[model samples]
Target chain A: MRTDAAPSLAAPWRKRRTTHYRRAEAITGVLMASPWIIGFLVFVVGPMIYSLYLSMTRWDLFTPPRWIGLENYQQLLFNDPTFFQSLKITTIYAFVGVPLQVALGLVLATLLNQKIRFLSFFRSVYYLPSVIGGISVAIMFRWIFGTQFGLINSALRVIGIEGPSWLGDPNWVIVSFILMSLWGSGSSMLINLGALQNIPTELYEAADVDGAGTLAKFFRITIPMMTPVIFFNMVIGIIHALQEFVLPFVMTGGGPADASLFLVLYLYRNAFQFFQMGYASAIAWLLFFYILVLTLLIVRSSRAWVYYEGAIRGR
Target chain B: MTTLPANRSFNQSSGQLKQFLIYAVLITGAVVVAIPFAWTLSTSLKTPQQVFTFPPVWIPDPIAWWNYPEALSSQPFGRWFLNSLVIVLVSTFGTVASCSMVAFAFARLRWPGRDLCFLILLGTMMLPDQVTIIPTFILFRELGWVNTFLPLIVPAFFARNAFYVFLLRQFFMTIPLEMDDAARLDGASHFQVYLHIILPMSKPALAVAALMFAQFKWNEFLGPLIFLNRSELYTVALGLRTFVGQEYGTDWHLMMAANIVFMIPLILIFFFAQKYFIQGVVISGVKG
Candidate 1:
């Protein structure tokens, strides 16, 4: 919303002055923006181009990078089982975990949206887990999912039921992470809450006058109105879940025969652990491609599902 | 008339039942959510024997306050805490200052390619950090900046955070243009106007950005995990991870103690500055 100093047509000198002012403003603007511009060049664009090049080459940290055209990509696609395994694992995690997280968030948000006492208290209690960093949460969950003395098992034992070793079992490892993911859905819940509040109560009131039941009003009005925010949360959540590294790294170490081996964790192992810079770069690019394609697909699908209140009002 | 009154009474009773049900569900969910934290705190104060007891001791009879000091002493937690403080503070300060400046340029200034630059910035946000991790590491290694805080700290000074910049720009747009025009008329330079008029007026938004950035930096793991190999240079997150890894058949009590210690500052920040946190989340959510 910047206003330019337009050159005055009537006064020749004023026009010159205006041009000078405009020039100065532009210079100042560039000066102010230079930090980010320089950063983008040195950090973002430069690394991206170099990484694309690196993806085709073979390099360990000690050796000079050997350029081999599309070998890394070919090996990753046709040769490596781990590559496909990591891809499948990450896909399932993001797709399954994000929807569950979004649904739970919506449910919690809907519950809290009622005219209630201690609204902030309930919100804070529920949202508290999300801000606690990943490592600590992972650490906490390692204990909570512990086989013998863990929180869940101990609770189960009281009812005479034995609990599974969550992190130890290959099948249960992903399930454990999924459960852990639920704890942090508070962030999405906050987002869902914000969307819920913005929804006009008049819609519900109008539904009430038409003799609609609670479920009908909710599904018909609230869910439709909330679709945009849900779409946003899903896109953000899926992208984030796809990059799940820290929890698996710290807790499971992508263990139980790579059951929890996420794409980024595998990428990290290749890059840092094995020091295969070139191959790791290939994995990174593949992960990026998946995220890009998934995000695009979601954005494309949003037209059918997402509801903008303004669109209806404008009509 | 009699039937109408009966129907009104039934509606009133049903409304009351609905309110009760809502409360019941909310309270039950809240308790379930809070249990892990309560378990952690309970474990932090328990003896090792108590930690493994069946039916799991919910409360310790004699609380072990010594666990905090004992766990902290086991690792170079003091050094790690200081390292984290330095990184989080320096980077957070840089993020707030640089982001606000860049945001001002985007929100208020007229320039060639300004809109394009902003669009590029938004585009970069979608590009996952993993995409550039390899080459960025190589670049840092070439510069001999690997195993140092430079990789973590330098980016903030250059407005590497597109989200913060976007947030601040959204805020800056809300400040009336008349204020800037008035400041300019009074012979204030663009920088002067940003410093005096915009920055001061944007305290709330600035505070939101700073708090969120600090939280992110303090919790950051991946950067330190990859860059800093030296134990002495470990941040709290990395240090805690190492602490957990160092011992086999991990001491649950000590681990819980360490976890709680790591979490206290963030918890305190949340309780005190929750309004900003919620506002930041809501703004990012609703707008993005």
Candidate 2:
């Protein structure tokens, strides 16, 4: 992670006759980054340390924290069915939503990458949903999926089909969320577009010469080359999906029978709404560990799939 | 070699077909994404009677420009707008200054534990913010910073945005080594080099960082919801939530109006800095 600039700069500084200049460089660097360091120590690191301590204590907002060792974690593991339910929901959501989004995004990006008219206009239109605030999107989805007088239902009625109450039904809430999420797939699409453009045209031409059809060329040439970007999007998508709160919070309130009760939503309820800070902190730590382990797994497995042209060349 | 010409004709026809398929798929995807936004714009301009009508109108019959002003005056929207503006401005400035500095350090300074620090920074990205939310809330409460803008604004100063720092570090690392060497030979200190040489060269990155921070802070609902308690201190996002209640009689037109108004600044900024935004994404991807 230490860039080449650092050592080269340091080597020259070490040979300098004046020590004042070196000290000044160090001082300035620290000064420039002080906000982040200070912020990290106070906000991020401090809270992280405190969360560990809080996990062992029962602390409401008004009352001084009362120490209760192992109770929160014990209750979460053994006693609470809601925690288990939330975990199940979140796992399903992450697995289902993340892959779908990534795949849909890649497909959309590939389609858009062709030499098409009004390319920028289409790109902007596709990206529109991403800029709309999450709450707004959720609200918009609420109207779209409304049981009575909804646009979706009306459209269904036009086709002589009955549209189920999407947000209202426990079985459909998660699906509704997943469908709503597709509107903002443009961010991942843009990233995929970048990866697609980086691919050499010669590869496609070479495939053409070899009589590789469109589908074959896409799978053999485009997909393998796009694996790294796909992996990147997948990891980020999982992380984002796992932490999904705003949409569910505004839309379903974790829903009719706790069907859409996401892990983070449950954590927020425990901490803010219910004032069980200790219990919430425990949930938070569990989530942190879950993400850490998952990311580590992805990173470890990346070598199997993620192909870097440069690394291949070096090899 | 005799079959090459026939193969060429076959390939050309297939390529044209493939192109046609691409256009078809892209147009459908674009429409799917655009419809919701179009619906919102149409809904916001509709009169209350027009909104709940049967066979819901795709466009309002008579445009209700009054809905915008009505939404503005519905709640403490003016105050909310000011609050959002203040927080976003402060946060963006803090993020840019802090992230750039940290990025510069990671890119240029050969300090002990720099690698460890950078790794830790990347590792933090994987850590769910939800895990930190409660502890951070408790910390804020302990410092009596809750129910104030301090909780939202203060963190920006501390390179709290590890993603931006990581991004800028990548950009800074790409700066030619000779530029720094030239600066050093000209009796320019590292600080001067960062300011005069690196800063100017990395304007696109800096602008990108600033724009992202602005969009993030402007649209932020959770942080403001958690920290700022009073109605007077509500951000535009927080205020918009007040439109919906547990009751069935929610004001659809007004809510849509507020949502549209809240989106204005973001849309304006987005259109203005789109070039830089695209550049930022490209650079981030390349670095990745």
Candidate 3:
């Protein structure tokens, strides 16, 4: 991927000409990167600063923002019960949903990794729902999880068992979200499959030579080899879990006493529905801070578990 | 390398059992994943009465295909479809054009501050959209760009998504630099090399980016929900939301019909360009 040959435009005087050529390349690089650089400033950095300011104040769209000096944050942290409820719901959803997605995704990937006929067909079927947008899936699942005539209840009734209202019951609302999360485990499954395929056969052969059984070979070889990919999935999946919005919004509307009210859902309500832009900004920042802290914790924990093939020296 | 005949036979029997078990689990998983689509399709064709029928009609008795026209006509879905098409196509074009260019810079060109800039871009990916939504909305509102598609479309032109840029950059890095050397020897400028050589040769990666952008824009709910207030300007996703949010009695059959209609384009794209979708997911996952 490296370019070693100097273009003809570079003169024979190696010192001065090399400097000139380097400058030209640098200018081109900056020109090429300018779009993203400018975009990062305007879209990401600028709004981030303004949001920090907005988080400190109380403002509706019509009036000028009144500076509240951390009142929004203080109120949210110490005074608001709904804020704590939203946090509790979102925390449970993310912590539970992420691990479930990772584990189920790995299981599905392992099943698919077996040498089989119609491999692509099976993979496609599993991965299909993930490509579909969140809104449509949420709507479809709303019907599937409905109280009286939903698919699950109807099926449960045939087996002479009763089923609880999935979306309508507060106790079962998070369970419904977890089930939905499992349905879209395709991305992690694909990643795990790719990692599984890339594991060298020699490792398994060595394990076979040692009279290692399937379970032993799996734990000693396959899992250790797959830790890097697993770590990647966990981090990405946790962030995604924390940011869930559309599904709860479309399916349950955070109903059954706000049991499914994810952090982002609460933020949306504050910003748009309630027109509490400043307080909404505070919630957004809190969510951002939470995600950052969680990501750092995962990265720190990965050092103990995640293995790098190239970097490892010995058992 | 030789094994006893009895040992080989024993291994073969065990392998057969393992294969059967794998098939069992895979089939169960496939069926579980697929049932929702099957149910949605069946419900789309069912009458209101059959939708709630106990013992669950897997197939609608009368096959009420009229639900499609009925649901679609009840809303200005035609207008919404057109609106969605405009937003998706233009935004996809912007994403491909800008992200590819930015990716080319990051992947191929040498510059001071380049690594720092790329790191900053990666950091932005970790920042949730909620952090910026309020201020970005206010920015657009102040520009009087509310109730318009500009808020959604213009950001793509600026290469707003770092993930796309990273994906394109990863793909770009795999292209051998000898090709660029030949173009450079021919007196091609950096832009010329990007335009004439890289873009033409990297069709698959570009297709991945464009398809991803199109899918994302078509199904986008939050942006459209916030910005576009007029029903006439509603994207298909927003239109479907309105259909489901009607105040009167919920019409399950028609709502399912509309959802199936909304999903048609995505399904078609999946059937035709399935490999790109899978490849994109694999690539995005591998390095991250």
Candidate 4:
């Protein structure tokens, strides 16, 4: 991950004083990067330690802290039904939503890469919703998914099919979320488009001469080449989905029997709304460990499927 | 690709048919993307009765351009717009300046443990803000920053976003190292080189970072939702959320109208600086 500037010591005389001046340069580097270093220490590292401390105690805001070690974790892990509910909700969202979005993105990218007309236009329109995300989009979707008068329901009516109140139904809230997510699938589509450009035409030509059909070439060559980028998108997608907050928070408010109660939304509720700061902190640490373990496992398993062009060539 | 050896005419015909089929599918997908926004625009112009009717009114019989004014005037949206503007501008500027400086250090300057530090920085990119949300909320509350914009804006100056720094570093690395060496030889200090040389070359990357940062903060929900409790201090995003609630979900016309108005600036930015926008997404993807 660290790519340093090359050691371009042009002047021979400077080489001798390199040790002394190099230390000087290091000091300058630290100085230049002091903002981030300082920021890290304060915002990230400091708060992380505080979060761990707070997780073990019972301290609601406007009250003095009471020493209650392991209580919050025990309550969250062992007793709380909603904690398990939210975890299941979050896991289901991530597992289902990540692949669908990544696949949608790749499919969109594949089609758009075919030297199509209005290429940028397609990409832009598809990507527009993601940029305009949050409360505005939530409001728009609220109208679009309204119980009796929604756009989707109207369209469904036209086709002689009755549409459920997309956001109103507990059984359909996650499906509603997954549908809303696809509107913003352009982000990874654009990523895959960029990755697809890097795949040389010669590889396709070689496959063509071997009498590979379009589907065959896609499976054998195109997919294998795109797996690294796909994996990248999956990691980001899964993480983002696992921590999904704004849409569900604003749109569903984790309502309709907490069917859409996402983990972070539950955490936010505990911290801010319910004033269970200690419990919320415990939830935070649980999610942190959960994501860390999931990420590590995915990365470890990636060795079997993720193909690096450079690594493959080296072998 | 060059033409295959056999059935050249048949290949050409199928190719055309294949392209036609692809367009058929793509346009259908594009329609799916367009429908919600299109519906928003359409609904914004409809009368309140028109919005809730079965076999919904596709377009308003009479255009209700007054809804835009009504939406803007009915709420404290005017003030909310100013708050959002202030937040986005401050967040964007802070992000561009801080991330670029830190990126210069990571990319151009040689230091012991620089790589390790950079990795630590990248590690933060994946660390969910949720993990630290509670403690940070408390920290900000302790600072008396809860009702203010400080919680949202102050962190930007402190390099809160690791992705921006990583992005700018990727761009900074592409600038040849000799320029830094050349400046160093002329007795230009690292700060001088960063400010005078590296920054000048990094305008595009910085602009991309700024745009993405602006969009991200403009759409930000959790930070402001958690920190800013007062309706008077609410940004437009928060305003829109409350706007939906105030009517108890009855006023779709004004709500959609306001949503469109809020979307206009970002849509305009998309049309104007799409190259940078696309570049931002591509760089974030391809690099990391």
Candidate 5:
């Protein structure tokens, strides 16, 4: 798409541009793309290179970086229980939250996929939280789940049940975070809705002719058909869940015994809070490695479960 | 038509019952989803004492319209709102113009290394921001962009968002190549072709990119939180958090009021441009 890709073999008859014309076009392309080229250098490549060095060193922003090969990784893996605890929370957040979020999205999308009315209205309502800032939503969640005067507690009182502290209680903080994760599940819901809409109506009609019931049709048809979309959402959800910072940071401050500290928050703390720049870089690398490993595992196993339309297996 | 017997009629009635059941379930779920926003609105109008009543005050006896002003004036919210607006507009413009320009370069122009560079640019999307954020902050600090809007806004001009570049590039490809050739046959150069031809035709794609970037910048937390530390320089997101601490200990009414105010722009933008937002999400989903 960029160049016709086989321009090197273009016949002389079709060649409208002379060498001068070609050189001029190249200059124009570089001139037009200069900003991105400069940004890719200053902002991206340079930083990544520096972080690679910083990852293996001990450097506070005030002092120069000192080389200490793999020491930060060694300590982060072995000596730091807080590191492990944060990783535990992060894993729980990624695994548990991703499944439930994907399930909720699938359910909502399926329901909305029915021949019901006012679908766009319902979709907008569901996706409202996702568009709002994490800070504001975090604030709203705190109020909704407040210990005494929250709506949840107030509703619970009507049913003769006492609502536990949502953000405050360590036991329920991550659960609270999961519920919050669902508010933004609308994006995936809409994505799933698009996929649902794309499923051929003929398939469902065929299922009906076969006397397949609704549940049977859903399991045998809809779910399998939705696997690609679901898998995409799952990988995305995993990455996002692992990196969740604002909600836990703003709501719980990773408190009530560091129960809600995510990988990014801990990294942010080490970098900015504690000024352990080198250690933070190391943490960042670990997270990067962790994501790569996890995604590779999913891609490796996707063959068994993931169903792609027109996709042939084993090449 | 022949009239059905009782068993067939029973099946027909059951079908009606099933429709009723689906509606019932959907409505219940809708209400559950909508309550948080409703409660926020209700709380914003409620009196301080009315906010936390055991029965949960559905409506305040007297609406405290003053809460809005009270919350707004409690801090430099007006300033923050302006700052956010300026930042969003400038950055959104920068992103669209620069991204579309680069997208033009990648999609239309045949330059050396075009495909190769594009692949590298697309690869940038996978590079985690966690790694890049620290060094960028340090770079900005050295440049004296710390505690200013420069660090937040400067990158937009550089068109650093690979997603948008990819999006516009994909969009530009959908356009017929003959359009460019026809424009070139005239006296127009590539820039003119981009300016007079591609852009006007690419409004839908450009609009989606702009709207999504606006929403993203409006809600953007981390960058603003890091770069703009001065109280007067705070964006609304940071301002709201700071207000939480500034008005500590059971000031839920004012807090809700502030939140509702903060949320108005987002809700309004979403309400008006629902199509673009949904399209953006769907586009990203499909691409991924």
Candidate 6:
């Protein structure tokens, strides 16, 4: 027993030396991550807590915060019609725009995945609108969707169809915003393209050997395998679409009778334009919860569908 | 398999038709994407009179090249251009530097609570900017950072961009640990390993992140819209808004011209870094 105890004691000394090395590594790691940690505390975490506190108070830029205690939430939930309208508009925008964008992106990616000439050039061309600033695209679409002398109307004229007033008419304004969003679906398309390329040619080869036609192979082999990537893009696209601001802000100005009044845009107007700081803070928290819940739901649902091919077999 | 010999020709012709149909569908989709940009250029080159012509000049008989110069000189175009360049460059550089450092730590270093810290970092991505905007605005105002580039540049230097950090971290993790072990054996410090080894190998990811950051910063409207008060400090996005005042209808021709100018840099960057962009995406996907 004494001999075993002596060896164990010596082993701990060796372990202590390794621990010293690990401690040194930990210190370096902390130093390296310090910028992010500091920024997180100062900019994100600190401000979030502060904003939560601010939401309970009435504070303008010139005045100190006065504790109102749930009044802001009360105003948002029951008193503000614009808040409800904005939520409705945002819901419509997210549901309509996100699905269209994702479907279009998948289609474009599938098309581009085929063996084709000038593939890179075409992709770059398609992706150009996305890299262009939101303001610039909004401005460009304003010209395209203009009531008079707009390019879209001119094109419609060539086809013997009269184009509707896109940004001017409340009925057509949301559609214009949707169109503007489609131009920037290139990023999601790129993601889909990457996912497509990764679909292990072997799987397709095996499917073909089994006499599966292209459509059959796509549905059976491609779709299931691509589910995870699709899920990722879907979640991200929904999140981004919910926060849609600049395009609607610059293009429609939340007008044509609030047709394009997104939640964030309304929040911006409330805080900046109307100077309703407390109310805006309340709107912000509500948005945060909305996004958080939606994200968690998606994540939860992903477990049943997102196939980890290797992990399942191994585990 | 031999029973279908008579139907083989039928299937062959159908295949040809299907192939042609697929091409037709894809070509139309491509055309749909391309037409808007083409229309923008065509409209920018047309005279304002021609722009309003009833039949509409699809091809301007005489291109209005003066639109570029006239549109530019009509406002502080040069200032806007300089302002955009300064902000984009600073933000891109700051993001690249800070995000790389944070990513390196998360990827390579074995530290206590490293996983927890990383989880927190990723969790922050779930928080929308709207939730933080009001508080960030107040904080910036308190710090006297409003009406300046500080709000844009300072946070970027402090690893404010979690998405980019996550992206870079994933890329960095793909690198062989043996490289770092070898460097350590050669007496290289962690900073030295980062500067000499990790960065050199992580060029593709860094370039992708930098280009993306530049594009985002260049196109950023909300941040500048909220923080920037004066027109002199206005980014291109904000500067374009000046043309859109309620007292007057927007000058479409000049606005389009300024837009063309604003897009040129991004267009060039996209074309040049297009390869890196695709490479980064593929690599990140494979690694994840």
Interface RMSD of each: 5.2, 4.0, 4.9, 3.1, 5.1, 8.3
lDDT of 2 by residue, B160-264 (tens): 879899889888877877888898889897778888999999998899989877887888888988998899999998888888743247777788888888888
lDDT of 5 by residue, B82-165 (tens): 999999999999999999999888877768788788888866866667878888888899899998899889999998887898
Best by DockQ: 4
Cα lDDT tens digits for candidate 6, A116-218 = 6678877887677777777888777777787666778877887889999888888888887777788778877888888898789999888756767767776
- Candidate RMSDs in order: 3.8, 2.9, 3.6, 2.4, 3.5, 5.5
Model 4: docking quality category? medium
Cα lDDT of all candidates, in order?
Answer: 0.88, 0.81, 0.87, 0.86, 0.84, 0.81
Candidate 1 lDDT by residue in tens digits, B1-288: 011223667867777777888899889989988988999999999988788788788889789989999999998999999999999999999999899999999987778998789889988877799989888888888899988899999999999989999899888877877788788889999999999999999999999999999999999999998899999999998888865652237888898899999999999999999999999999888877
Comparing only chain B with the true structure, the TM-scores of all models are 0.96, 0.93, 0.95, 0.95, 0.92, 0.93
- Looking at model 2 chain A, report the run of 10 residues with the lowest lDDT sum: A1-10
Query: Sort by lDDT, best first: what order?
Result: 1, 3, 4, 5, 2, 6
CAPRI level of candidate 2? acceptable
Candidate 3 has a DockQ of: 0.57
lDDT of 6 at A255: 93
| Count of backbone clashes, every candidate in sequence | 0, 4, 0, 0, 0, 0
Q: Please tell me how candidate 6 rates in CAPRI terms.
A: medium
Return the clash pairs for model 3, or none.
none
Residue B175 alpha-carbon offset, candidate 4, angstroms: 0.8
What lDDT tens digits, residue by residue, belong to model 1 across residues A29-56? 9999999999999999999999999999
Instruction: Assess every candidate by TM-score.
Output: 0.95, 0.94, 0.95, 0.96, 0.94, 0.93
Give the residue spans of candidate 2 off by over 4 A: A1-28, A313-315, B1-11, B246-248
* Candidate 4 ranges with C-alpha deviation above 4 Å: A1-17, A313-315, B1-6, B246-249
True contacts kept of each: 0.76, 0.52, 0.75, 0.79, 0.59, 0.67
After best superposition, candidate 1 residue A72: deviation in angstroms?
0.7
lDDT of 3 by residue, A1-315 (tens): 112222322434333436777788889989888888888889998999999999999999899999999999999999999989989988888888888898888878877876789989988888888888999998889888877788999999999888998888899999899988889988889889888998999999988888776667767887898888888888888888898999999887888799989899999999999999999999999999999999999999988998887655643
Native-referenced TM-scores of chain A, all candidate models: 0.93, 0.93, 0.93, 0.94, 0.90, 0.91
Instruction: Give the runs in model 3 whose Cα sits over 4 Å from its true position.
Output: A1-17, A313-315, B1-8, B245-248
* 3 versus 4: better TM-score goes to: 4
Q: Candidate 2's residue-wise lDDT over A122-192, tens digit each? A: 77777667777787787787778877767788789888889988888888888888888777788888788
